[model samples]
Target: MIESPGLLLTLLAFVLVIGPLVFVHEMGHYLAARWFGVKADAFSIGFGREIAGWTDRRGTRWKLGWMPLGGYVRFAGDMNAVSQPSAEWLALPEEERNQTFQAKPVWQRAIIVAAGPVVNFLLAMLILGGFAMAYGDTRTPPVVGTVLENSAAARAGLQPGDRIVRLGDRDIHVFEDMLSYTRIHPAEKTTVAFERNGQVQTLPVTIGVDQQTDRFGNNYRIGMLGIARGDRVTVPVSLFEAPVVAVRRTGEIVSMMVETIGQIITGRRSVKELGGPLSIAKVSGEQITLGADAFVFLIALVSINLGFINLLPVPMLDGGHLLFYAIEAVRRKPVGPEVQEWAFRGGLAAILGLMLLVTFNDLGNFGLWQSLASLIG
Candidate 1:
């Protein structure tokens, strides 16, 4: 028997990080359903066989599942966890049908479907706003303190005291902003604008690529520029201003996610960079070791990702449902059941394929293939 404390910690951290997010996401759907007089038949925090559960006064089955991956709310009139309407449900008694999810106005149904992702985004913003209020915000200027020998910055004629004002089309307000831009554009040539000696200068340089490995052996390839910031400063944000700061920070994170996806699609970044549940587990464990704040920050980051992903226009996702609702509104009718079924099938396959790809990447990152090969040899 092999017992590793790190493995245990990773498992524990994965549960801790994913549990609340899933609950919050499902709760959003549940609450919206309740608000619109739609009955939720079951509220689940996970999938597969139920470990433990209870029937609430409203007859909603609240349950915990064996798997801790994802969760859902099964509403009345819904055929499955994805909230697809059932033919039998539509034929129900008029009085009972009124309380079913499918009976709601298309606008109301759209809101119910959108609430999950919206709440996820809100949860992230709340956590980030709390951090901004408690610890203030970083306001370091984008001044170059040192130019490493033969670095991208050095090759671009960047020197100490040069203040980066822009990268490509993005305005760099701080050193961190510049870092964020460069990190996603690795090995890509881009124009940089900076101020030096009271004059603004612009030059094109190829961002360097750097491979980083965590203690858990997970690897990341990120963009790098061979320049260091001059100094760092944290300025206290007022309570009223904290929300603004949080919103801006959240937007920046989302922007980076979009940019990264664009890079991947454009073949500038490899698809191997995509991570799945295993990566989340490893990073959650590592963050917990760093401290509570670090772990909480990771939670917020993952929460944002969850929201962004669900908003994708892929079938079976919240965004896909919303897309259907939009079409219904425009056409004055819901999409045909046959079309929806086929779309859902395609969506499920795409999601499954993505899961497989990410899991393979995670295993590869952990050197599972090499270990198995060595043992076989």
Candidate 2:
């Protein structure tokens, strides 16, 4: 139900972003299968009806599907894209059975299944590193240059030219470190240690929570100490050093995701923050407008998100496959087929339910339901 120019932009941006990501993900599976001597039936970039494709020399059908949301690779013995063993593969001639996916050694199958997400992480790191190499890192010192009147810092007797040394038990190295700590603990009181006139003083300060909304209409609460930096410092980085930075960047993002997911699961964070395809499409469009660097960064962030999510120990995910392998290693055989079937069904149901919930949230974020209610009223 997208309309006109905005619809066009969303579609274009979504395809541009998702197409490469899906392609790369599936390609990882495809290449690993080839390496392991496992025959691949189809290499698809999307789901459902095929739009266009050609059969490769290796007898793999490489096709693009109409739905741009997800893609999968079907190995010779896969019951479906999830790589379940098919009856056909089970009944294959003894000689050809070796080519089937389930027939492969557990380690080989695990490698093939793992390659997809592994490639995603690598792709994000490469993009991030390239960005770092092109644009030097911008940093700001943790020194307090100014304090707003009546703000938390001023109320706590903080003055300009004080250097923040610690918050609670954590040491503050830069402005970002302080910002990150504050963002997670809005309105919470913590001890702040700062150096004044060469003397270190620790004071109890209650953080001020500010409610803010982004252009996308998502609301967030941040802790404000009302401090400002003189100027941002730009540090030049070499191409060789970029990958190291990229690794750290990816680790930081992954750590943040883990923390957020834990909070959401523990009910410490609102589920309304969960998003779906619509949110991604909107952000993709927005980032496309922001310029190549921003869009590329968004892609890397999403790629990391994708990789990490897939590795969660949930059934129907890459990590689920790994879990099964772990159990198989311990039990000296695969889990019962019936148990796997039920687990996979339940996993699919859970995935579908989450999708519905997130899609509803996306609608709310887009003001679609609000506009409709207004029209009706």
Candidate 3:
């Protein structure tokens, strides 16, 4: 279990990781608003009680809140952090309406809303690209590190220091290549060819599903390779080669996101895999312990997640507002207040419900719920 120092470190890492990212996200909206001549009433870091605040030269309240989960930019006439425009406030005189967000052109409003997520994704891409160029990549060699006792590898007489040449007849380029293919090919028999002590050997091994329970007691059948990776090599490249690696990494992230979404919809994956603030904190602390490079990489991944989530087409979100604004741009008139209100409400409900479920999963991941269940059972 992660102890007290790890807990404190995790909390600190959460703040350090999320704080600047959220600030950057909100700042995009603020800057866009200013550019479009819209006044922001507040620019806050975090939510809940304001521990410290001061009005800037532009009369915008810059505050740091006690709760450090998220932050926002409150445009004039907005009832809350989200850029959902206010209608009642627009009923004031022309001078007051001019300051209201509802009075802005749809194009301008859309820009302000979309800017937040755009900045986050761009920032993430930059971080990922920089890391790739700076550190290069590490990969395991196709050599056997350690074979589990009495497992398939041992039964087949496989030993350490055996360099895997191929899986079946296919040539293996790297160690991960062998691992990835093997994970999905569970419950099948395959011939593994390797070079051991200057001699080529062929070993036939049978793959099987291993049932394991998560911290929440949820069972999963995982395919095991019965080996620990030990032989590895690092490939270094010039800065010129870094962007290519970064672009590949970014593509991989997007692909994973798409695959995960599809798996969830297809029931191949469970919602229990979805994480929230607590999960982020746990990962942040663990990554920080891994090193600065790992910590930065995790932040970039989260930044991408934050960006992708905001772009979802749901009311009250940036993407939702973009959708509405696009409609208004086409029709040359805003949607009715009642309709917008209901849509926003529905979106809010969905987001809140998802938050609650993910929070439950987070607690489950921490094993708190399992402990209670054990006591009761």
Highest-scoring model, lDDT: 1
Task: Give the number of the best model, judged by TM-score.
Answer: 1
Candidate 2: give its CA RMSD in angstroms.
3.1
**Candidate 2 ranges beyond 4 A from true positions:** 1-5, 80-88, 165-171, 188-205, 213-220
Q: Which 10-residue window in model 3 sums to the lowest lDDT?
A: 214-223
Candidate 1, 218-333: lDDT as tens digits: 45678888998877889998889988998999999999999889978988778988889998998888888878999999999999999999999999899999999899899998
Whole-model lDDT, candidate 2? 0.83
RMSD of 1: 2.5
lDDT of 2 by residue, 1-377 (tens): 22223778878988888889888888888889889898888988888999999998978898989898989888877765445566766788976777778888888888988898999999999998887788777667888888988888898888888989899766887777787777766677889999989999999999888899766455678788888776878788798889898898788788768867776888867798899899899888878876888888889988888888888878898888888988888898888778887888888898899999999999998889999999999
Candidate scoring better on lDDT of 2 and 3: 2
lDDT of 3 by residue, 1-377 (tens): 22333678889999989998999899989888888888888999989999999998988999999899889888778764444455667566888668767678888898999999988888887887787666667666877889898777787787888888877545666787676556545566888888988998888877656787643234555556687778568788677777676766676677558766776777766788888999899888877877898898898999888888898899977899888888889988877767887888999999999999999999997889999999999
So what's the TM-score on candidate 3?
Answer: 0.74
lDDT of each: 0.90, 0.83, 0.79
Cα error, residue 222 of model 1, in Å, equals 2.5
Rank ordering of all candidates by TM-score, starting from the highest: 1, 2, 3
